[model samples]
Target: MKNELLSLLNKNLLAVEPSLIRKFDDEISKIPGIIKLTLGEPYFNTPDHIKIAGIKAIIDNQTHYAPNRGIVELREAISEYLRRRHYAVSYDPQEQIIVTNGASEAISTAMNSFLGEGDMVLCPSPAFGLYRNLAKINGARYIEIDTEDDKYELTPEKLKTYLDEYHTSVKMLVLNYPNNPTGVSYSENEIKKLAEVLEEYPIVGECQEVCVNG
Candidate 1:
């Protein structure tokens, strides 16, 4: 029965390897008195105020499942935040905002929604491994454009070249900013240039921003 169940599992899943980040973190964690910074682990504890509010919610019996998109209050707050930070960008809370558990869920949702079998996900090299794993799980091919020679930044010219080469199979572009492993970010002008290149293609761009605070 065990062998039969294993055989029935998705081959794509079986082909996926464990995350090297987590593996390294686990190994290094065993060393005493070492200040480890792997796996995006937070250095600070949860604030007292937030902890109290969470306890209060449980006491008030507000533990039922939230709306599929998320609570309206939270979504509204997110919309307002984007509006304030981006100056000109605004999202409608009721129709456009979705509050995900974390970046992982949000990325998974976007990839599953846009990708199909044999589709291609173009990722910049040295990105978070989750993007590549998720693409494989969705039966899509993950292609990396090495950015080591370009100061670890994916320029518009490089992006356009890859798109042209894999135009047919490419359906999504995965971009990470304040990029993991490299800690590099694109300037405003750089973003605009890439956007101009992207405008000519039909691919969906999945951009991940790393925020320390929830």
Candidate 2:
């Protein structure tokens, strides 16, 4: 029976490990009354409006298995939400958007979709631990760029320095705003400058994957 379980698992499973946050959670939860700022676990509950929507979905019998990409209506809502809140452009939810379980799954799925063994992912430090772990689990090398020297942010010059040094070693540059540990946000001008540097390195191609939130 033990051998059967091992046989069923993929070889890559050996390289994967439990989430680092969960490991810390075990130690912190036993502290009886310690205030932990270790992992970026949110203290708030799901807002009432969101909770009620979940309840309504249950009542309306929306419990059936949704499409792999997720329900079209929900995906469309997300598309509009992004356009209204973040980007100026609109996207087709049916074609361009995918609703994942959460940002964690979204990152993992995106990296898995685009990266393979020997590919490199440039993660600006100090990043969400999940990003580093995701690269390892997906068989991609994770390269950390020290952003502390760049005023706790990735500037165009800093980005170019890395690409010039690593050359094609970088397959993707992971960007996060309102960064996890630093809480630093990028200005629109800063984003544009970074984009300008990215445009010069057409070798890296277009990077559309970005994440925000805890």
Candidate 3:
């Protein structure tokens, strides 16, 4: 019998290509004495302190479902950390902040909330691959501004040019620091310059990207 069960699945999912990163890992693992730099994983096991905390939490019966947004204390700690790091931003733990399982899940939650049918996202090319798929998953499209020629950095002039050419159809911008793949980051001045350009798009929100410099 034909697999009629396939028809009940999401049509959009059919178009998603397998993750290139994972495929690259599988092929590279077959090569003898090859160090696979493409796959991102820690070189060390979990720290002893973290392991102790987990054991303590489990013994204390703290392994229950958390609030939908996340635990309030952890959310507050995140908010404080962002502020202390001179991001100059503050979010309320009770509402604005959410603790997700990982960066990918956070991106999904954010995109699902922000993107609607046919909306567009602007991302610099040669970035982390997940951003492109996240936009598509949310029923939106993404415009990858190729940054290969610019030494893997997105400039304010480039952003302005694209925004002008596209005439405001772009719904969001994805900016990353210590960006994946290229491993280049924006200087404080460079970020300020980009912010100046973005001021014109005051209503545009929900810029999605991952930051993991640590």
Candidate 3 local accuracy as lDDT? 0.76
Over the stretch 161-186, how does candidate 1's per-residue lDDT look in tens digits? 99999998899988888899889998
TM-score of each: 0.94, 0.83, 0.89
Q: After superposition, how far is residue 68 of candidate 2 from its true place, in Å?
A: 2.3
| Best by the lDDT measure | 1
Q: State residue 108's C-alpha deviation in candidate 1, in Å.
A: 0.8
> What is the C-alpha local distance difference test score of each model?
0.86, 0.75, 0.76
RMSD (CA, Å), candidate 3 to true, equals 3.5
Better of 1 and 3 by TM-score: 1
- Measured on C-alpha atoms, candidate 2 has an lDDT of 0.75
lDDT pick, better of 1 and 2 = 1
Worst 10 residues of 3 by lDDT: 205-214
Instruction: Write the candidate numbers in order of decreasing lDDT.
Output: 1, 3, 2
Clashing residue pairs, candidate 1? none
For candidate 3, give the lDDT of residue 187: 83
* Better model by TM-score: candidate 1 vs candidate 2: 1
Q: After superposition, how far is residue 200 of candidate 2 from its true place, in Å?
A: 2.2
